[model samples]
Each structure stands twice: as structure tokens, then as C-alpha cells.
Target: MDKKGYNTKGRGGGNVNEGGDGDKWSRWWWGLSHRKSAPSEESSNSNQVQRSPSQSKSPKQKIRISSRSDKLPFYYQNWFLVLLTLMSLSCFAFALFVFLYLYPDSIESSPSSTSPASSEVVEITYGTVLKLMHEKTKFRLHSHEVPYGSGSGQQSVTGFPDVEDSNSYWIIRPQPGTSAKQGDPIKSGTIIKLQHMRTRRWLHSHWFSSPISGNQEVSCFGGDSESDTGDLWRLLIEGSGNIWRKDQRIRLQHADTGVYLHSHNKKYSRIAGGQQEVCGVQDKRAENIWLAAEGVYLPVNGSE
Candidate 1:
């Protein structure tokens, strides 16, 4: 039962009398600030302040500190809401973790199944070329897929190789367009009949190889360089047709291939259209103005 009292053992003590003229708060203020003509704390205060690098707070102090936020009503401070929110988030995280652990694959992904997949087909056609570059390169030919109409009264024929005398070469077979490979065994009724006149060109760098219809240009004696054939050579040949689609180009990958012609007896020229024809040493000797094409009026004898 030690109540707060004054100490007067030294001259450094305060002059607080037992019967002071004030209440507790005033007394405390007087004790801290008021004094006779004594020196200030700057000159005489000698109590050393003991501090540890780290302090272990007492249980009472800890309880007092923790009670500050806890004792307040929900409207008094924001910390209660913050703590509640953190606790709710922790609980939700724990629930999510447990759910994922129990059913890993069942968790709905951020990109739901309703989202579009990467495997959708996108159609792209530019200028004269209607190219469809896709992961799946091959397309199965169907009679409906063939670009033919109920009219044109056209029929399919064989012996394209026999006419060319080179099975290694045939023409770019129409519809179900394919790369340089064996022709697929299409249905018998399937044939390519066009209402518009079909045309193609053979692309050669050195000389006029041939074209599906028009005359071909050659590097004069047809060398790989333009110097071998000058620009002064359009009048030497003939050019017909007002509109020849540049997209309608042919690749003379080899000499063995020949184009399929329909029932038309008119003579037509052909040439390489795509790549600049590059010639090597042996190509110089082959004057056989790279046969572009041989026209036909009948399918049976169309090979040139």
C-alpha cells in the first residue's frame, strides 16, 4: 500500500508539502515544473536512463497494448475491419488450397471453357492468291468441293501421263488443290469444269519456258541475267487476254509434268510465273525453249 509521496532526502528534492494547495493533477504538474531557486534538470538531473537493445514487454503492458485495438467499438477505428478482412482472406485462401488439393483438375480455370479455343480456322486471301495457310495442310477432296457446275458438259479423262510420255510430270490438277505429290484417287464423276477461261504461266528466270496461254519471256539466249535478254523485247511476241490473274501462276518444278487441257484446238503459250528462273551450266545447253504448254482441242490428245 505505498501511495505516491515526496522525497526530501537531498537538496535536489522538490518542496512539496504534505498539505499541498492543489489536487492530484495540479500536484503532478507542480512536481514536474515548480521549484524554489534550484538548478534546472539540464544542470543537475543525474538519473541514468537504462535501455536494452531489445526489451521483453511485461504481460500487463502487452495486454494493455493489445486491448487498444480490441476494446474499441467497430465504428471507432479501421483496424478492426482490416483485421477482419485479413482473417477472411486467410480463411478463403485456406479453403481454396484445400479445394484445389482435393480436386486439382476440377478447379475452373481463369480462361473458362466458354472462351474461344486456339484451334479456330481463320480464312485469309490476298490479291490474286487465295491461300489458306493452316496447321492441317491436307484437304480431302469431295465432289462438292470441286469447282465445277452442273453445266460445261465436261468429263474426266485419263492418259495425261501417256500423252506427256512422262509420268514424272502432269499438270496442276484442279480442285482439291494439292502440292507436288501423287494425285489422290478422286471419285469418278469429279471433274474440273470452269465457266471462265482458265489460264496459267510457267515462271522461268533464264528463258521463255512457256505459259498456259501467253508467250514466255527468256533471258535472251536466256541467261539468268537481264543482260542476257533486254527489256526491248515485247514486240517480238504476242500477248492476248485483257485480264490474266497474276495469282494464276504455275511452277515448272520439273520437265516431266504437263497440264491438263480440255476440248479446245487453239494453240496457246506458257511460261513460268512464280519464281525468277535461275539457270545453271546444264540449263544453258537445253535450248528446247522450255516447253511452256501444248494446246489441245480434245482431252484424249491434249499432250504436247
Candidate 2:
């Protein structure tokens, strides 16, 4: 019994309160401690339960997130490559458009236009504008203002390799006293005149020798109003038809010199480099054959 009414027991030095209020206080402390200890135990058990699930699932969630994060850059890289390809195609298309807009004739006079097999054959009539291609040498009858360094010293005639040359064009005309008119289909033996489209000169051959072959010199002489017997060339059709056709091969014999218009593989080196010589050959041969090519063939008698 002490002043607080608690017994200080001797066996293990314990304090046992004896009064009713002290007993009540002791019970309250015990109850409070029990309640605190109960809450701590429950909290510890709850924490263990929560930690078990989180720890178990953490590695799976991390794997999924890491996989998505790794693939995200590749997905964006694929989209970037697609956009880059589209932009490159757009730039190429724009460049092609600009090129076509600038040079229209480059498309118009392409190899397709000059191909005889591809073009529609129309009647070659008087006053028709045409290019005569040498069948053997594959050269066009080309004339320029550049005069011959030798021979007659007139405007020189040469076989040009290019299909798109505007100087290769020739306008067909009848002889001075002929009854033939424009748009009339030419007969096989019809004597005609070829006027150079660019220079307005007549295709003429005379007694002078050629620069290369020493055959009769073929030159472009006279102007728009000039007339001469040397300008006449008689058309000799090789095939069965007397009426001239675009697909038929023909020869032009100079009425003055009686030589066929001819070309060969002989290329000039100086003034007209890489160009074959156009001259007059007395004997009818394969090199004299010419075909109508790359021209606006007029329909016979204006019938389209």
C-alpha cells in the first residue's frame, strides 16, 4: 500500500493498484494500448498484402511500358520516311512540268512524230510541205544559207541527220508551164520543183562538180520569184502505183543534168562536219531512193 493506493508486490516488483479510480485508470491504459497495438498490427498486415500485389505486377507493367516506348521511335521513323518519299516525288513532278512548259517543240518533233510507221499516210499533193528522207543513209535533205566552199559557190545542200531540223522542210511546186495546181495528187512522172522552206531557194543541179563525190553539184539557187529549168526534178516512183503515196519510195532526177538525187556515208569534215553529201548520181541505185517523212501531207483536192 503506497500513497497512490497501489500494492508494490515483492515477487517481481509489480504495481497493483487497489482503489476503484486507480483500477479504472489501469483498465483505460490497457484498453488504449490494446487498441493502438491492434491498429498497428492491422496496418502492418494491410501493408504486406498491398506490397505483395504491387511487387508481383511491377515487372510486367514495366516490360509493357518499356516495349511501347522502344517501338514508338520506330513508328515515328516509318511515318517520317513516307513523308520524305512523297515530298521527293512532288519535286520531281514539278521539275518535269517546268521542262515541258519551256520546250514545247521538243515533244512535238520527237522520234515518234518522225517515224513513218507511226504516222498516218496521206496523199502527197502539190504545195505540200515535206521532208524527204534518204532511204539508204537515213538523212534528211537539208539546206542552209551557208554556201559551198567549193563547186558552184551557191547555197550548199547536205544530208542532215537530225529529224527535227526546220531547214529540212521543202514546199512542192509544179514546173513553170505545167497545168498542175495546188492540192493535186502528184503522178509518178510529174516534174516538180522543190523550194527550200527556210531559205526560199530552189533545189537546183548543174554542170559543176560536187565537193566530195565530184558528181554533178546539187545546190540551192534562185529566190522566191526566180524561175529556171535547173529547178525541175522528175519524180520516178519505184512501186506499182502511178499515183505517189507516202509509203512508196521515189527518186528525183534532175531535168537539166539527168542525174538522180543521191546521198552516201561520206561525211564532210570541215564546214559541214558529220553531214553526208547530197549530190547527183547518173546511175539509178539504192542510195537515190527517198521517202516522204515528218511533214504536213496535204489531202488530195482538199478532201480531209
Give the top-scoring candidate (TM-score): 2
Writing each residue's lDDT as its tens digit, candidate 1 over 1-304 gives: 1256546333545455455435656878777666642445534443222222124346657888898869997656787888889999999999999988997755343222312233532111111112111111111100111111222212211112112121112122223242212222212223221111122211112222222222232211111221211211110001332221121211121221222211111222222112121221222122112221222111111222
Per-candidate alpha-carbon RMSD to the true structure: 23.6, 7.1
What would the TM-scores of all predictions be?
A: 0.15, 0.70
Q: List the residue pairs that clash in candidate 2.
A: none
lDDT of 2 by residue, 1-304 (tens): 7789756664556654467557778999999999999989999999999999999999999999999877886548599888888899999999999999999889878756654454555678998888999999899999999999887899999999998889999999988877889899998988999999999999999999999989889999999888699999999999789888888899999998799999999999998999999999999999999998888767788586
- Residue 2 deviation, candidate 2, in Å? 43
Query: What RMSD does model 1 have?
Result: 23.6
List the candidate 1 regions with Cα displacement exceeding 4 Å. Answer: 1-76, 107-304
lDDT of 1 at 88: 100
